[model samples]
Target: MVALRNLLTALFLPVKLCLFVFHHRVGRVRAARAAGDRGAISIELALAVIVLVGIAVAVLAVVMRLANTVKGKVPTDPVVTAAP
Candidate 1:
């Protein structure tokens, strides 16, 4: 029972330590955010907008390529009518 307890403690000690550090770091970030840290928010928003625009551009390129491929395979010449 003692050995099992020791093993469990060894496994969980690092996890607990990490959680403690993360909790404190998050608290400090929250405090800073509450203290009027607007620049980070703006930067994050800009990055998000840039990412969305990039995705839109990529999708547009793919659609254009598909349109061109389909257009190439289509028969564009006019059909002739038979004489009566």
Candidate 2:
């Protein structure tokens, strides 16, 4: 039981740290946002998501263009072979 607990703790150490950090940062942002504007975090998050999605779309477009270009350069016609 002790070994299992230790193993679980070790495995989750990074996750715990990440959650802690995320919580701390969000708390600070919430406090800051509370002073003047409400829903500021939501607006910021929405904008960030939009920007990230746009970036993802651009990257996907470039990848698809390259893939199509490469595919066009490859020979795809079946070869005729004389059977012996």
Candidate 3:
């Protein structure tokens, strides 16, 4: 049994070494692809944020104009006078 075990170990050592090297190389490739994806996502996020901010500013400007118009049309005088 010990001899059989030794023989099997010797036979499989090369296959194990090949697998280890393949996994290490694949891991490096995956890490490089992930780095590129991160940069692209960051740029897209920045552009989206800028567009949202522009929309918010435009909405605020329109609201301010409408508020001013309403304020100008409203009368300051009371509608009903209080009894003395």
The residue-by-residue lDDT of candidate 3 on 1-84, one tens digit each, is 999999999989967866785576557557757777656555655675687679769979999999998898788645887889
For residue 83, model 3's alpha carbon misses the true position, in angstroms, by 19
- Tens-place lDDT digits, model 2, residues 1-60: 999999999989967966785686578678868786657766766676687679769979
User: How well does candidate 1 score on lDDT at residue 31?
Assistant: 72
**Candidate 1 per-residue C-alpha lDDT over 1-84 given as tens digits, one digit per residue, 9 for 90 to 100:** 999999999989967965785576567567768998867756755675687679769979999999999898678756889999
The candidate scoring highest on lDDT is 2
Which parts of model 2 have CA positions greater than 4 angstroms off? Answer: 1-37, 76-84
Better TM-score candidate (1, 3): 1
Error of 1 at 16 (Å): 39
Candidate 1: count of backbone clashes, pairs at least 3 residues apart or interchain: 0
lDDT of 3 at 81: 79
Enumerate clash totals for all models, in the order shown: 0, 0, 0
Candidate 2 vs 3: which has more lDDT: 2
- Give the candidate order by descending lDDT: 2, 1, 3
